[model samples]
Target: MLLFITIGALCLLLTIVGDLVKLLQLSKLFRCISGSACSDELQQQLKEARVKVERVRQSSNATSHYTYTVKLMRAENELKAIQTKLRNESNMQNLKGASVELVVGYLLKGVLSLVLFIITLRNRYTPVFLFNENINFEPLEGLLSFPTGVHNAISVPFWALSCNSAFRLLFNAIKGK
Candidate 1:
């Protein structure tokens, strides 16, 4: 019972924190904290590419019909490619914060899931709630018990899921959404 309560509380806490992070829009701070090395490098490359394109355009003979020379075309393509890369980098940076937090949240959730699995496996025969009278709903009993074989039981995973659902509902209600 103590283990169940502890696990329920932890699951509730994790769900609440995950919700808060999304609701508060703290992803930008996370992205900033994650650094801007990729964007910075792309910007530098964009500048160099622009310079090469400009130099190629200027060095070509103005009076000649060969204006679209191979060098100039190649430089222009490189410049355009770099510009595209920089644009993509900026876009990715905008999403990075949210993605980073999502990954961390997933990792924490995974650890919690493992703990639940271990707990359930250890207490396979122990019913979370014992019925005073026998209830012969085999399918429902099996589902409620899940990893545990105990009849009329609520397993750790089920309990944790309930805790998460309850907390999320409360959180959303408090958030007015």
Candidate 2:
């Protein structure tokens, strides 16, 4: 059970970390785009978006889990508008790099999941929940095996998001908006 809980927590932590990393990357992308041959209005908007992301990162200190959660939520909400604006402004020719990044991110996640699954299988498909005790049994093994399923299930949405992100980038680029 402890092992299950640990895996669950790890999944949640990874998801949050992924979002934070994306926020920072998007912020940097906005800054870079702003410096390109875009309109002054677009440049200003991009800078504002980057500033909002920076503020979220600063406020979402990991000192307390609750504080981090709240701030992440705040960051996500704030980013929605920025995302929409970027979607409006995206061009396929310009976002080829972003599309590549999306693919790389998905592949990395896939590799990580595969490695974890391999590790679990090597450990006899049982997680070491407690240090002093062996947590192996038919019933317990059945129960413990659920963590991998849970982890996989949890990762599905992130994979979908990766697909959506790549598709949106392509679609917007093709639309020439």
Candidate 3:
């Protein structure tokens, strides 16, 4: 049980790390989009916001933290402005490529999760050829099953988002929106 819990925790940690990496890549993508859209002002806002966010991170007191929260909100608003500007001005080809990449990533995640689910389910139903018949570890199935379930849960939203993005991009390409 401990081993399974440890594995589950490790899996969650890995997922979080993966999401952070995705966010970092997205920030870089935003920078590129802003540059191409001639959003110098928005870029400056982001830089300032980042600095303020860092300052917020450094502060320990609640009163100062509240002020930092305001700064963070302002920063988020600026980010939304930047996104709007980029959406209006970014190159269609670049946007389409990015959308395609995102779709592929999401679909791949969904496919892998499906595969894991099938494998775990099969293991649960079938005999363990490698293990002795006298030895039982039915509890271990919970470990495999739980992780597969979690993966499936996480993958579904990504798949949906990817599909939605891809369809929007397709429509935009067709309509020049």
Give the better candidate number (1 or 2) by lDDT. 1
| Tens-digit per-residue lDDT, 6-58, candidate 2 | 44444443344444446557544644655355445666776776787677678
Candidate 1 residue 97 Cα shift, in angstroms, is 2.2
RMSD to the true structure for each prediction, in A, is: 7.2, 22.7, 20.0
Q: Per-candidate TM vs. native?
A: 0.46, 0.33, 0.27
Top of the candidates by lDDT: 1
What overall lDDT goes with each candidate model?
A: 0.73, 0.51, 0.49
Output the worst ten-in-a-row residue range by lDDT, candidate 1: 125-134
Question: Residue pairs in steric clash, candidate 2?
Answer: 92-173
Q: Name the TM-score of candidate 1.
A: 0.46
Sort by TM-score, best first. 1, 2, 3
* Candidate 1 structure quality by residue, lDDT tens digits, 14-55: 766666556667677766766578778878888898898888
Model 3 misplacement above 4 A: 1-21, 24-94, 125-177
| Model 1, C-alpha of 42: deviation from truth (Å) | 9.0
lDDT of 3 by residue, 1-177 (tens): 332233343333333443444555654565465454456665676677667666665664655767878866776676677667656654554675466556655665565456534544444433222334565546553443342343112222233333345644665576565
TM-score of 2: 0.33
Q: Is candidate 1 or candidate 2 better by TM-score?
A: 1
